[model samples]
Target: MKPLALPSGSRWSAAHLCGLSVVLVPTCFLAVLFIWPVLRLLALGFGDEAGPFHSYLRVFTVPAYREAILTTFEIAIAVTVLSVMLAYPVAYLMATVSPRMARLIGIGVLLPFWTSALVRTTAWIMLLERYGILNSVLMRAHLIRHPVAFVYNMSGVLIGMSHVLMPFVVFPLYTAFRGLDRNLVQAAMLLGAGPLTLCRKIFIPLTAPGALAGANIVFMSALGYYITPALMGGPAQTMVSQLISFNVSEQLDWGMAGALSGVMLVLTLAAFFLCRGVLEKRLKRRVVTAARPYGEGLSGRSGAGWGMVIAGCAVMVFLLAPIVIVFPMSVSASPILMFPPHGLSFRWYHELLSRPQWAGAFFNSLKVALIAVPVATVLGTLAAIGLARMKGTFAQILEGLFILPMVVPAIILAVGLYYQLTPLGLTRGYWGLGLGQAVIAMPFVFLTVQATLRGFSRDLELAAMSLGAGWFSVMGRIVLPALMPAIVSGAIFAFITSFDDVILALFLTDVRARTLSRLIYENVLQDVSPTITAVAVLVIVLTLGLLLSSLLFQREKS
Candidate 1:
């Protein structure tokens, strides 16, 4: 749809002013709540008493800090490479398979993707620990005399991070694959081009931009990752995020924390822009070279080779392994985490409810989501509507500002808010944390609603207005109902974002008001219990339910 045009003179002025007002609500909300605190935090790093660059100089000079920064880039690069490589076979399979099989394959990728990171990490620990299920099975098979070390090492760190991040690459590659011309592949095959030659000459070049885009995202996200490395990695594998957390929680060093945050923020932005530039150039080149002639007698579909099919199946198993393992383990009667159950029982489920701390944390998560989701939805919807009506560089700038919360690392936001609110005593309850989560959740809602509005018909609103209806009446009776599917989709995303967050909860709320994710993280650090497995199962179920609900809404909209 084209941009909405307005009437001349005072009418245009009125409409323009109205759009500005609608945009201002979310702008001011983010400005005061998100942008101010982060700026304050960054300023702390540069304004130290010793000198402007004192904290930064120390970050480079200190051996522990220097090694952490290097290790962070190293792990991020490794995870990026692994994710891109593992994504290709699965993406290819999805694009080539029947629709039903593709949906099944998608569920395998997305079920774990949608679930909480903490839960997946916990499941990995159970499967890969020294005396864990994998080792036990291998020993029983006489494959090895003793358990292989998996968790609490570099190997464990790579596995956990790659599993968590590979979906970032898969979806993009799937899109790129689906857009490929089947005629090109069939023509090459008719010329007796083998699978390896076809892939190297045609498929790889066509998909390179998408792969690079995915790699960029994985690398940036990995830079800010805290939970996986903290739980799975040994001391030598520590990343910059852990250092920032340590300075704030353990060392009482705000300046150092701020300096580390600054470094991460710079690196993340640099990677984003650099990758974006490369992708744009690649897209332009593809467009210029995309004038391929259609091949006659090429109706037959190209299928993945046996090797590709086997690799794709293996990747599907890897994606589903953690989620699948948690179910049987949750029902195990044994206090220890064993694969085959001593007996099937709901004892862990009972423990989950009977414990006061567990019950309280669950309810706290609900209360915070209740407060955050609606606020994010309202602010995001209004921002989308206002932005859709707008045209110019000013609107583009505002859009960027609106999305900055998502681009900036969550740890930075958490620490900034912690520094800003701790002094005002606002960190004592769920309200502050709810608002902090709203900052992160709003961007998802904005992006979803904005895309929906692009396809929405403004003619209905104009028709309603022409019939003597007021703006409020038109929006309430006409616009919102039409946008309900998108609204619900955005709300689900916002709900999950708020519900699954741990970083903000760690810093913004104390023990008395902690969230479930935070409590799970703490418990995993202290002990690996059967009850945690039960909780993981529940979280997975909840996430899949929400995902299904979103899909249902989209189908209904169609």
Candidate 2:
């Protein structure tokens, strides 16, 4: 039978209805599963006068809680400053280097992101401990007669967190630099502008938006950070996240915990908007200035400028030192954290394998992330495509809704999920953990895939249909192939996010479904062991392997 054709200008075709249904499924799923839960948690923050309000008043009225809030902001600001300083040169190199070198530097920035935050924080513990590698190296070199007090202090927290947050700064700056029109820089040079003049007058202004964005991203993420400060910083350096966790777990004060969480959310949002406004204003001013076009005189550097470039490279190495230190420490068999390892051995690798808890958690994380990755990728990619195809207030709203997960604090999301999923029989199971992870993973997938889809044209699909291909067949043979690069990239991101996430997993996982990150958290908080570094190294290796394989696969396919 011939397929029935919809009338001209009709908006109710079967294909359109199918598209709507597909979009609606995930939209409804998010509303019921994510939005409602978060709203409920927010509601708890403003409980009756005798409950959360009283707790909030006590918290606000108390000097201790106020100090924690101040400490959190202070640390976040310090981290942001350090990250920008360390990342600027790496980003500059990425923007101005040979394509091969650029790709290598980009990989360096991305590698840390693939590993779990808990693992990274624990690795810092081994490196910063009195008996740790850093102290041993300095003592042996006669740089210091005694081990330095590095760990359990603000210095360690700053170092570990700056390492973790640097990538956020680098990636955005790299993108901004890449976005620059080379011709504009050349034009400035052709007009006899010195390197300093060109940079101050041209390059810096153009990249300021990215710098601002990256700094805000780093600061906001650092504000809510739990692992690094918990592992590396002492009581004196405690941040608000630690305070909230303490209230919930140690004090069993849910009301105050919720109130504190709400406060954090408000502060983060305010900071983000404030930064965004300043960036937008600067960008508007730059646009109005109407700078000269690029590519007139593109080569040659002044001697003074070259010195600055060398200084930038030096800073990059400094930022990389801690991560670079982890390798030798992981292989040490001295039964202690010692630099140069005293002598290297594979004993830690053996120990990592022998520990059933560690091995079990690793496998469980792998299983859950493997399931979540593809599911999130497919859903997120389709949602991006569907949203792009439509145009209206509804489409814009839906797109914003899809991206909301990334902006919301993970702990807030976790608390909400804990309460909401319990009654639905999803709590404390693989399903619960996976679903919660997918919610967090979805925004990243959507962002990457949407950016990719923006460059794609729907004409290919129309052309395929005109040649007698059915919708599914065209999508499979043509559309999917075109989207493979984006799908792979988005899926890798989703997988890593699910693999490394601790907050949601902590709230959702039971004994039967614990993830590697949770295991690291438990080991650090309950039992500090050398074995933690071994597990951390393994996680880093696994993530690097996955990322390398994905890149190689993409290269071969292209």
Candidate 3:
């Protein structure tokens, strides 16, 4: 069949219009819904005619606020370092394994991510409580005289955070490792390089960008974390998020909250730019080295070094321990969390079911996420397709704008939504919460779908059009099938993001619209219950199942 050729100028103009529309819609949406609200909130920090800038100045001058900032950074850095160290080996294993094994391992790493952060944080609380499993086991074996203070402190906060953040590090590193040229490693070995030398000179350098990207993500996220630290850490260990929440809700001090949020926003942007600069440098270096022949002859020791292998396995286990400890504690018959339960029972699970509030909250969360996921996914995919096919500066700017949700702090978004939605008669309802979640979820969907579109050739779409199909027909028949995997992946991410969200839900929810994460937050703060542990376990199971299903589907397609 002959192609339908359009004049070059007309084609370019059409592309420009398409791009402009793509960029304009999202840019307008974000400007109204996200950007304006945040700017308005930040304006509160400067004070109105009623008062001076004393509140902002006071917060900055206070030692307590300074300590909070320092503590937040300290914990974020620690979590980033720990998450990377643990994620590297798992990523390597995933990279080197058979396809089937890699898929299974990938599913395993993603499992924790499906569970809500609040649920995961409470699980850590149960496991690290004074009479929790760790202490119970140690005491039973006569290893200690009294229960250790693991929970309600910095140690517990770090352990819980690292567990939750590990998957972020693993996924990026896994992707990077999978994309590595195996020939390069073999070439290094052939050049007589030792194992350590190969790792230092070749593997490490190659994977550094992924490592940096993952670490930056973890660090940025950890900085704004509220639930985990609030649940696991005591008053002394409070992070900046908690402080911001306290100012807004407890003290009714909007000025300080706004200032703190602005500070966090600035810091986050700085970290992102710093990471971008480092990545650009690494990419330039890689480009320079592209023409070099693969180095060979890395030193071999006893066929893959069992000692290093064992150490790596041990680290994996350590990373996974917090999650592993939750099962026994939930199933324990004893009211208090204990290890090797005197007798196992389903009491906690039954408790979770019988409790009306917990069960109701679960259903509420499910309903909201189910509704938000599909809506966000479709919108995001449409935007991605339009941007990909269109050629204009407007399209590029819009694509970037669509992903701004990733950079903005959820707490700030929550505060903004709380203020804006109230006037629209949307606050404290399911619709309000769902809307807020969709705003955040859309960005993930956009990224996933856009990446998927980038991988596909536009020739199929052109061919379909040449066959006399209309625009809709070409998209549905040709582009849709090719982009199905990405759509599904993006939908899954949207679902999980909504399911795991706490900050937005916390602000926008009243009793009737409370989400599971919000419910878990209340339970942890009000009364840490075994019922919460049961809920946490159920969340973990559901998430794992969803992740496994996604992997299986992807594997079958492959």
Q: Relative to the true structure, how large is the alpha-carbon lDDT of every model?
A: 0.89, 0.78, 0.78
lDDT of each residue in 172-222, candidate 2, tens digit only: 888777767776766777999987797799777787788889999899898
Question: What is the lDDT, from 0 to 100, of the residue 185 in candidate 3?
Answer: 68
Q: Could you tell me every candidate's TM-score relative to the true structure?
A: 0.94, 0.89, 0.90
Clashes of each: 0, 6, 17
**Of the candidates shown, which would achieve the greatest lDDT relative to the real structure?**
1
By lDDT, the better pick of 1 and 2 is 1
lDDT of 3 by residue, 236-330 (tens): 88888888888888998888888888888888888977997888788777643333222122234334455444655675666556566678777
Q: What clash pairs does model 1 have?
A: none
- Full-model lDDT, candidate 1: 0.89
Instruction: State the TM-score for model 1.
Output: 0.94
Q: Choose the strongest candidate by TM-score.
A: 1
Candidate 2 residue runs with Cα over 4 Å from true position: 1-20, 49-52, 179-199, 277-300, 526-528
State which candidate, 1 or 2, has the greater TM-score.
1
